[model samples]
Target chain A: MTAAELLSLTATISLVILGIAMLIAIIRVVIGPTLSDRILALDLLTVIAMGFVAAIAIRTGLMLYLDIAISLALLGFLATVALARYMLSRIKDEDDQP
Target chain B: MTALLATVLGCILLLLGSCFALLGAVGVLRLPDLYTRMHAASKAGAVGGGMILVAVALVSFDASIALRAVIGAAFLLLTTPVSAHLLARVSHRGGYHTQTTMFIDELAAASPSKGTLEQ
Candidate 1:
């Protein structure tokens, strides 16, 4: 069909799909078997959120919220690294105990 | 002509990226263990997110949008793999394991005392 129709349709479908994905990741995070599993699910949630932000930016034609996506990308990475370091410190503590 | 072409391509790519993201979420839910699920979530999820950024670049009417989208996608590409690597290493260090590992634990085998690696 027309360009406007195609763009809007794509935006709707992608938003819906990423929404579902984010829900699934939340479920996993809630019942994940381990701390690491929960952390990974959180990471997935961030990725899905990025896609969601991108979809919104396109749908609204604002082009500004895409900046949010960039910030999320960096913030999510920092969070993951911080979590990993926390786990490492925990491990070292356990090692020192006995 | 070129505008229509780009719009069509952007739509297709956006759809594909969302599908990949959904697949990654399903994998995170269905996979038995942390490692395998991380494999799905980190790799496919990152690529899927990157594709969406590219689609945004393509669909947007302004060149500035494309520039921001590209920067965001590149940042995503750079950070995701590094974070995944750190997570996997931390999992190994923290004694996390997967049941369906049909392969050897080469990291442990190669380095018996994994403590020094992190130190």
Candidate 2:
């Protein structure tokens, strides 16, 4: 097989693997008992999504997907920070009640 | 010859990276505590995700695209640790205790207690 064909095949397989990983992360986000657990899962899901975008870019020969990956990364960071802040405020309130 | 070797090596690296990412997700799910889970999620996820990005860059062979992947990887590496640290600090201060920890927290002991207000 040609090198391009091989690379394409590899990209397809990697994308499938990444998709499964993202699914696992999603399950964690859904069933996590604690807020921190959910946030952690969500963060992972974003990273996996970034990987997926890269795979797609490789398969399709388009660079635009990289832009999408960057946006996802930024969003993930914001979400984690917001969750941390919320958790911190909640803890302070709980400390005050006793 | 070089092209064939690069393609095979890239595929192998990509596969390894996916495995690490899968393991990271499993760690996130199976680990017993928030801190440990975060350790797995952040470190494994960051490295695995970065490796996959590198593999993609190698396969594509476009300088701009590869640079973008590198940028994405850099961002992940930088952000994951800071976020994890923030979460851990917040959880600790919020009174979340590790389920299996055996030692008294010295930092908690060192802090002066808020004085009781007279009614």
Candidate 3:
């Protein structure tokens, strides 16, 4: 296969693999027994989604999508951190109780 | 020749990264307890995702794509450990359950007000 064909082929396969990973992460979020589990799954999901965006950017030969992927990477950390802080405050409240 | 070489390298990296991602996803399910699973998903997921970014940069070989990919990968590497530590701290404080084999309470030990938080 030619160079373009090879890159596109790899992009397709990578997308398929990332799709599977994202699916499993979604399942965990839906059925996770603990708050942390669900939060972690959400984080993983965002990262996987960014990977999807990156793969698409590659396959389509678009540099602009890379900007989206970068912002997603930066912004995704906010959710996990916020949830963890919420949990921390709840624990502190519990500790404060008589 | 360089084009072919770059494609081969990018393909290899992409596939390897995807495998790492798949491993982390599976570990998220297979592992017991929030902490261990955190170890699995956070670290592996970040590394895998970073690898993919690198692969994308290699394939494109342009200034804009490479710059953004590098920034993204650096952001991921930096934030992953912070988030994982935060998650662990929250879980420890929230009294999340752990498996029987996990018997180290280092954080609780440091606090001194600790009174058998392990389950």
Candidate 4:
């Protein structure tokens, strides 16, 4: 096969693998028993999504996907922090009761 | 040619990195406790994400994309640990005491009065 074909094939396989990772992360988000578990799952989900963005960038030879991936990363971090804060405050409220 | 070699190597690394990420998700599902799960998530997520980013950087052969990947990786590394710590601290404070396996409870010792109030 030609080099371009090889690159395309390789990129396709990697994207499929990343899809599997995303599925696993989604499963965790669905089944996690605790709030923290769900938050952790969300964190993984974003990272896997970023992987997909990277794969697309490589496959299509586009640079814009990289920007999208970075933005997703930032948003994911904010989500995690917000969840953590919420969990903390909820726990604190529970502690305050007699 | 060098390009073909790089593509092959990049694909292999991407697969490996995705495997690590998959394992991290599995770890999240299987770990017995919050701390252990966080450990798996942070370590695997950071490293796995980094590897995949590197693979993309290499495959694309673009300096700009590579720089963005590096920045994203850095952001993940910086944030994962802090979030994990916050969660752990909140869990501890919430009186979700570690099960019997916990040998030391520094937070408990540090705030004996609060412990009494909760009891």
- Tell me the tens digit of each residue's lDDT in model 4 across B1-119: 77777777877777777778878877887887767888888889877877877777777777777787777778878887887788777666655564425767787788632211121
- For model 3, the TM-score of its B chain against the native B chain is 0.85
Which residue pairs overlap in candidate 1's backbone? none
lDDT of every model, 2 decimals: 0.85, 0.78, 0.82, 0.76
Better of 1 and 4 by TM-score: 1
Residue ranges of candidate 2 with Cα displaced over 4 Å: A94-98, B98-105, B111-119
> Candidate 1: lDDT of B88?
86
- Residue A47 miss distance in model 3 (angstroms): 1.0
Candidate 2 has an lDDT of 0.78
Best by the DockQ measure: 1
Higher-scoring candidate on lDDT, 1 or 3:
1
What docking tier does model 1 reach? medium
Give residue B51's lDDT in candidate 2 (0 to 100). Answer: 83
**Candidate 3 residue-wise lDDT, A1-98, digit = tens:** 78888888988999999999989988888888777889999898888888888888888889788888878877779988998888777666667773
The list of candidate 3 runs beyond 4 A from truth reads B97-101, B112-119
lDDT, candidate 3, at B40: 82
lDDT value, candidate 4, whole model:
0.76
Q: What is the DockQ of each candidate?
A: 0.61, 0.49, 0.59, 0.49
Count of clashes, each model: 0, 0, 0, 0
lDDT of 2 at A89: 69
lDDT of 2 by residue, B85-119 (tens): 89877765654553437366675566633322111
Q: What ranges in model 4 sit over 4 Å off? A: B99-106, B112-119
Error of 4 at B20 (Å): 0.8
Error of 1 at B13 (Å): 0.9
Model 3, B1-119: lDDT tens digits are: 88678779988888888888888888898887788888888888998889889988889888777877888899899998899899877676555633225677776566533112322
lDDT of 4 by residue, A1-98 (tens): 87667767877887887788788878878876666778888988888788788778778878788789778878888888888788766656655895
